[model samples]
Target chain A: MMADAKKIVQVLFEANNIPIPPNRAAIFEQFIKKPGSEAVIRALLANQTELMEKWKLENRIMDIAQQPVRILNATVGKPYETWFDFDQLKWKDIAAFEFTGLEDIGLTFDPKTSQLSGVPAQSGDYKLLFRYRLQEEPEDAPYHEKVIPIIINPDPKSLWKKLDSNQQDPYWKEDDVTAFEPLGDRSILVSSKRGRSHANVGSFREDDFAFKALPGGWNIVVVADGAGSAKISRKGSALACNTVVEYFLDQPAVEGMAVFDELLKQYKTDNSEIQKKINQHVYNNLGKAALHVHKKLIAFAAEVSVPVKDLNTTLIFTLFKKYETGYALLSFGVGDCPIALLNKDVSEVTLMNWIDVGEFGGGTRFITMPEIFHDQKFATRFGFKVVEDFSYLIMMSDGIYDAKFVVEANLPNIKKWKEFLADLGGKNEDGISVALSTANPDIVSQFSAWMDFWSPGNHDDRTLAIVF
Target chain B: MRRLPVYLLLDTSGSMTGEPIEAVKNGVQVMISSLRQNPQAIETAFISIISFDSTAKQLVPLTDLASFQMVDIKASGTTNLGEALHLVATSIDNEVAKTTADQKGDWKPLVFIMTDGIPTDDWQKGLEEFKKRKTAYTVACAAGSNADTNVLKQITDNVVSLDTADSQSIAKFFTWVTASIGVTSTRVEDAGKEVTGLSELPPPPAELNIVV
Candidate 1:
């Protein structure tokens, strides 16, 4: 350890900045023996601050400097303070800046007042800049003192609006389709309930296999993923997944494959309109949202408003259908998650050739690109499969990749996959958020983890689905 | 080696009651955030607060700025420059000087004294004490409107006179302070000297209009 430290420190130190003592080896040995010790033995030191500092630093409580603890003042509005006497403030106020990391620190400007200070466990230099936005281009601060940094984190969620019901599930509505006839009776029956718990991934299986009463020789299945970025990718994914399985299962046995073709045509037609709506939504709304936020930010800056940045996000999905001869399907993903069809026997997972229909990630909606309307169908790039018989199917939204699931094809053990999910639950919450939040903190291993080293890793949200 | 004792001797006199006080308050938070971001600054900087209104008051005793809570200062009285100055001197003489290896302290003490009004009380005694102490750290003065420039000049070679802190000048002043401190920190490590800059523009000819 001592030798390692000598090598590390010697390599990093600036030449001629400070002399590296010869006996530093001994000092490093002492350091490694008692890690985090700031003590420098006089015998192993070059001239710097007096040796006494070495002793003082050794006993210092924390390594970094700490800002003084301040008893910040809050704005006063004791309920019945003052009515605007021709608009004159009667109470004292301080702009309580929002501090991050510290729990329960709230910053409020009651009906227009300054911020109040709250208890912060950690302290250091904080910027205390407060700016006032004016109607006009209002002059810049005489100098650039405009950016006042507070020494401590001021809590921003002072008004943590009751987690709005607006915590919306405003994405593709993928509901289970339940229209299959009884295969077990071999004769006739009524409703059949899908036994969903048993599967590779706990999603609804194709009609019969999902049913317990099915004494069938074999069963069928389907898997799908939803794109989260494009305005309507989720809708397209759900529409495709739900419709494909339902159409086949509901059809009379003789008309099964024929019915599937009609459903596909209808899907293509509906998808075209949906795509148009989505394109318009992005072009109309996204630009406006950015403009609104940017204007607010600029005003905030001009008034020395808040020094906070805004956030934006993306999406992806897949869809497939099951049949007696094995599932026949058309799947299309606009942005990232690549798709593949593997043989159910676990023998071969084929990477189907598919066109790259959508532009890559960078919040764009294709306002205008000519000669590519009918020529550039969103579902132009697609993969289809027909097998003699199959056991399982899989689809995902790159989140599985975080666990090192290969995009084109890689069959991870079910148990290993479950463990990966558990690791995910341990690291983050469930739902689509696993998409954006999968960027791991491991710096060393991250570079090698991705196919695109330039991107470091897939930042777009992730979704993974498997069926059996 | 003791930690550098940084005394923020602010003027809370009546003249500095409104915008001035607010700006100072805002500036302090900015400076605190700045220091906290710097690995070396936070470890070495210990801040003491002394606000002078009717009489100089020690709102907060010697503590690291990281831990120092900013008091909502109200400026409603006379400027006790003399008392505040004396307090700073005594603080250095008794508290800072006594810091040692056993005590866990810093190097040369630093005082960032800012004021906007004339001194009505006797500051001569405090000046004498200041002169007597062996110079170790640094003393910087941010002069405000109506501040006695001569009085600030007496205490330190480094002085930044701020004209009326109208709405526009806040960012410029703070930026200068940040730049100066950053450069000063670098210089401290490189040249081993306290680097100080007057409130001026980038070069000599184009001075930033900080002073009236």
Candidate 2:
């Protein structure tokens, strides 16, 4: 029986062209000494063909199972090209391949060569479904389908070029504020300064701010804090701030006011219902704007041949308009940047869009992050306020708040924040009011210096933009 | 946003007394000083330290690298590797934030274990528990000739051996650790990836060797 078992093993190895290693041969000899070895050998030989077939099937499935179609991102009005190749699928026996779901998006797919390529006509999410089957499988064999998502974005090359040119200028100093100037009667002060740590290392400031006076007393202010870890965050923050302001400035006055009017129409009749409607509309508009910035960053990265993640920054902006009834403030934020509305007396401060660090400490969402689309809460938050009288609106990066208001590395309540502001503003309740109302050029220097105030461990680039 | 958590498990048995323990302390300080220069590490790295002797104790809780301060370690008693492993498992379960439907969680932790003596307690069960929550990277260092390389191999594939626990050798080990961490932090920031293996580790000075 032992000799027969040995002979069977040799024949199996020979037929498969497999070498019997000395160690494996010794183990095989030891196995033959066990009881019932003859029955085991017989069963093994009888089932060898079936096992081999099963193994081949499993290996084929594994080869084809995780052949992922890379999700392609493209900008609207831009020529985009991408292909799905059968080579990556690694299924040699595939009899046929079929593609669906591209017709609606105006994309072309060739199943003969498993190629898909086209420019998406619109800006949104799309799924391309692909199905394939094996040639040797039964007529009723189950076909496998893969759904790949394609994201179409708005064109940002022109905007990105505008931003990139600014970044590349050798005349621009590393410590210079990105943009700071009073627009009109409404004193808009924007200032950004390099953090102490960044200065020590001679690194460029990653914070940026932009503001422009829109037609009809409407003002748009944007502040962006670039992620410290991102290599090109300086460019990211500059692009974010500029892109948001540009978007608001380019919008037709009527259309921009239409959003405010919708909120005003719903404002007091059914406060809760109106708030809900306003929140939804504001979220949609702001989310759209944020998505535009994200797409622009992606497009810019593609044009420059850099990873989009290098250009990650948090965005916060407010579009303020004065109406007969009162003033309407529409603010949106992604990440840890804060936007606040101060009462007429400057005694009370209300955080328009409040953001806390995510579940994990030291982590915040960026406009360019893919996760922003998956989770709406992290994508953007909108706050709408219609006030009869207010001192001014203040928007700032976390650097300012982390130093002054944050308690034990946690976000402080509105009451605590008001107190902190009062302290920074000094004994007079009018300190912040005076600072915002001042038209003097020194105010920019003062604000820039104020950001450098001593803080134990909070040393990040500081940016503050005030719309009065 | 998520932070990169790093854990250091040090054996504080009597075998690590005198200059060896002092070198460990200085090494930690060197790591802190070096990491402070890296803005990415300063922004994303969180650190914790655990020490084991007759019993195990968490010497430091998970704290941001910016605020981390080296705590002096005192060596005494037998090597209780089992207790240290159990403590690390518990701390990870308790301290590491988890992802939710609305927000992401912290990155997987990087763990380093340094021991100069064999365990005086049963360590298999504790190791099993820790492995169930496998860290992104786990590197074990056998600090002296008397240390057991075979047991360390069971814990992690990335293991190194130090010929002696002298101050210079320990300093070299810590410098390598700091460099590894610095590279990891940059990778996380630049590529948004949590590296699970050390493809390029700093070469060990003459006193140390890779344990295969």
Candidate 3:
């Protein structure tokens, strides 16, 4: 801190907003003639700056002291830069500006540009005390001090905790699962991962999925999302998915599908007579599977001595059969999850099931709700779609739907579906794509990693099954 | 981004001049600091403040947690709660984003009204105006025995009462408010639902009791 008489005088004159006289050289000489040492001169300059601040506040020349300070925003680990834009204050007319609290947050203030710029290392609210001298004020005018608040926000991703779920529980399920299976002409890639919200508190992943290749060129894909508030929804979701897949795997259900195959062939030729029979047959088969799940969940709840509502979960499944003409997709859903099929040209999407959303506001009807079984509209939850050819068929829990599509109306939107497909192809925040081709050896891991992509306020267990 | 809007309606009548007013300011400062540390609240919660004295005015517009600042307020004059409620309804209409077919909107606003005195104006008119707007939840606090809990009950079913309008009790109330906001922010995504009453909020401290 070297003290220069000429520098001090020049600063004082600029702070007073007055041009220096022609004899400025003589004025500087006279100003410091009586000073003893550098320390004393430096002390005198510091004292002047303080006095100027006091004088400015006392006069109320500006309302900076009387009003709330302007607040600036920043994020931890992100660069922050902003200029001083105070009301009724002219930047050029101020001189000898200084700032406090910048050093504590690893920020620096450059007086030349009057800008504060740096990367904040912490998250919190900080009030900066700014002291300055007005160029237009008298030499005896005190320096002005104004308070400005800067808030640094924490990175949402950084705040996430990733503790493993408890393995000691009797109904404990694995935190994550991924699979890549080959099905006749198409391949199925599935991934289910615990969301950040669940991982934050070491909670179980309440999503489950199951897929199986039936004997007669047919495939079944089931996905279930357990209610977050439900106590044992993890087991309920597992039972909901496994029960349906196993039902189709059993001898009776297999024979029933064989009957369905026969009915489909006859219905293709004779429209009216066989069409009615085919509808009845498809409904009976899917309905039986759903009932099996509902009954099994109730039994499981009783065995565990817990309320059935504790096992609440959303269930969606599709049984699609391939034929020389096209593909027949029969779907049933009892909740908010969606099953979608995209056409070969990617211009159209068929949402295969009636969604139980919007009507209840934010509540999703679950398979565990016994009252729905008696509703006549429950039969309408079953849907049938026949597509000539398709690019992809997908089934997902609300964890994925809420983040990707947001609402039920978006399920049938071709544009949203296209964007979602692009997102799967790696156009996401993480740039981790699930290559549709089976040739990609790391497809399963890639898909699982993609599930970890961050969407603020949308962390829930995710289960996605894609067929392409 | 869809935000969780929080409205704080504070009564700044003449009775709150000394320790009560200072406590209210400190309580708010503490609440802001605590919410910033919560991952759920930090990501979604946006806060606004309305202060009512002889008349009501919005002290701060809706601001995110990071940029929020507390301004000093001087307590004086009679309580005009009716004006405050009208301002809240209008601020919500102007500030909150409504969900539509095209875009996702903000979560329903959460309102907390704290007052130590009865309204000197026609509060029913303001209540009528406020009823037209939808909120996820509204909790009214009777700051002391002087406050009319019956009146607060008419404003909202979720009403709580405190023995005194002192620093300790008010501070505890704000802590409970902070916890309520934290839980609601997470619940919105965790269950894909909204909070509608005190049952959904955290339990109040010993200093506060349920009005009902």
Candidate 4:
């Protein structure tokens, strides 16, 4: 790496609203020298030109000190950081506005460092977002780029009129099946903020977590994440969430989690008797639809022909059935995720780290496939459980785990607790309030201290389900 | 898993003036959003929108469905079905070239060309270009009220009539397209699950009769 080129890199960061965090700019310079180096380096460029031309998105980095920096999207108006840490994702006054041509939007902050530069390409008025994770202190810099709105196409009024011109899909206004609903016995709290940072995209208020009443003296709390990258992921997540809950509710009132747990196990075992049946059923119901897509994509690949629809995305979800004896939380979906409990009323019974099943090793895998879903052993197992009224149970996707290298890591970072979570990894937070009411430090502080929880990079959507 | 690329070649010509064009436009957006919503639809279906009037233009370029944006198209100019067909074929050729021995990409390109007026440009060159079209794509032309089914047949032996380009017919075309796309992508996704790919596809929709 040349000396001046490195300094210019610093200027790049400074220009983009981020400082050349200590050793990071240097590492970035060296890293971008490989064969696909151009692509790597372009991601680091200050503007959206590189992103626009390459179709690569803007990214957010958590800790430069970490080996591999976590990256998120940069196309939206407000970065994912803004969503993750809205209050801190503030900007200086210039004008009230929005960005355009972007899709997903998010934002978060680093109280440890208090910096913000996330997914959104531009901001409301004029202010570029920036973070100094590795710097001694971000405020060390005298000035920051006030991110400004850029409208390459100003015909927005017309565009909006056309969009609302009564010539749209009936489903256009409906929460596209995968919209969020409430989960657990908890009352839902909903909020909103400008999403996608696009001028056209107004402030969005959505609640993707939901809970429904069940017949058998049980309350069902469900959290399902549509594959952010897959086409029908949203639909798949909706189907899985709706189907699982419906199936369980249909069964006769099972007294306890243990009872329901056993029935679930049996149902899964019975699934094998119809493995062929499940396979054929999946093919019969979803085959033609799936094949229709498969052929077009292959055709797209073959250049024989193609369509304008996208079909790649992944999903992660859970269904919690609250029974008298410890509620049973049944979770099955593609991709690995975070599952844990947090207690608000008392100090104990909150395990933010995932509770483990003695034999379960949860990294990341495709649980949406028919083979996996039909696997009685894997599918029927109640990987985690929750008893008591407690605060809430949190389950997040690879967005956080991937950024934290948590496949093998645990929460509230400490030796005793680490070993404890690893043992209770799959079911760490699923137990009853029978204990933990004895501990100190309230639930708010528990969250207050866990600052690095928002995954570093902003590549995928962040979904956190709080089942209280 | 292999994806089935479905190209929506829409006619944005000035002639698509009133209800028919609006219906077509609304129908396209509905289909895109619907496919995204249908758990039964996304196994491997991907879409691309190509609009043609005087010049064939790729409105939403060839990208995965998850990434492609559905832009608002304004009606203008003369019908250049030939030019659009040529461009679609050319785009397919270029994209297919990127496939390697290590991975099998899109199954087969499904080109749905929707037009009302006759081609104002030379379509023979496109017909010739498609003749050399490796069986990589299964081309299906849908004719509207005044559409040139004959010209469509020349491009691909099979031509589908979208009747009046009315909401109903547009819906029918989208259903067939969605069904066709889903089948192609699903077969490809399920294929990797086994040692052998599925033997064959059920014939296209009943209304989508194959032309000899």
| TM-scores for chain A over all candidates | 0.30, 0.57, 0.82, 0.36
Q: Write the per-residue lDDT of candidate 1 for residues A167-256, one digit (tens) a residue.
A: 145442322222223332121111111111111122221111122221112122322233222233333333333333443344342143
For model 2, residues B1-212, the per-residue Cα lDDT tens digits are 46788999999999899999999998987787677656567666889999999999999999876456566689999998988899999999998887664334677899999999999999998898888885879899999899999999999999988989999999999998898887776666443456777565556567768888
Give the fraction of true interface contacts kept by model 3. 0.56
* Cα RMSDs, all models: 28.2, 26.6, 9.1, 24.3
The parts of candidate 4 lying over 4 Å away from their true place are A1-94, A97-468, B38-43, B97-99, B135-141, B192-212
Model 2 Cα lDDT, one tens digit per residue, A1-468: 558668877787789997677879888787766678767787886688678887887677566655555555655566666666556545568876677887677678765545566766665556677676777667677777767656554332211111122435432336757345665445676678776556554567888888877765667788898887787888888888888876666655337557667668658946788777777777777677778888999998898788998888888888777777777788888888888888787667777876756543356778888777777564347777888877767788877755555532333355665665565465332343224445455666556555556543356778777766
lDDT of 3 by residue, A1-468 (tens): 444655775686689996677777566566566556455677877998789876864565475455565647788888889876643444555655689889898789886676889998887777788887766667676778888777777766788789989899887999999999986578899989988789888999999999888877779899998888899999999999999998898989888888866666665534778877877877899989999999999999999899999999889999888887778888889988888888998999888886787632356799999887899988788888666789899889888887899877777789999999899898987788888887899887888888888887788888888999
lDDT of 3 by residue, B1-212 (tens): 57899999999999999999999999999999889888788878999999999999999999988778887888999999999999999999999988776667898999999999999999999999999999989999999889999999999999999899999999999999999999998888677678888997888889999988
Off by over 4 Å in 2: A1-173, A176-185, A251-267, A271-288, A346-349, A354-356, A370-380, A407-412, A426-442, B1-78, B86-112, B125-138, B154-158, B163-167, B178-212
Give, for candidate 3 chain B, the lowest lDDT window spanning 10 residues.
B98-107
Worst 10 residues of 3 chain A by lDDT: A86-95
Least accurate 10 contiguous residues by lDDT in model 2 chain A: A156-165
Model 1 CA RMSD to the hidden true structure, in angstroms: 28.2
Model 1 segments beyond 4 Å from truth? Answer: A1-468, B97-105, B135-145, B185-212
- In candidate 2 chain B, where is summed lDDT lowest over 10 consecutive residues? B185-194
Scoring only the second chain, what is candidate 2's TM-score?
A: 0.96
Count clashing pairs, candidate 2. 2
Please give the ranking of all candidate structures by TM-score, highest first, separated by commas: 3, 2, 4, 1
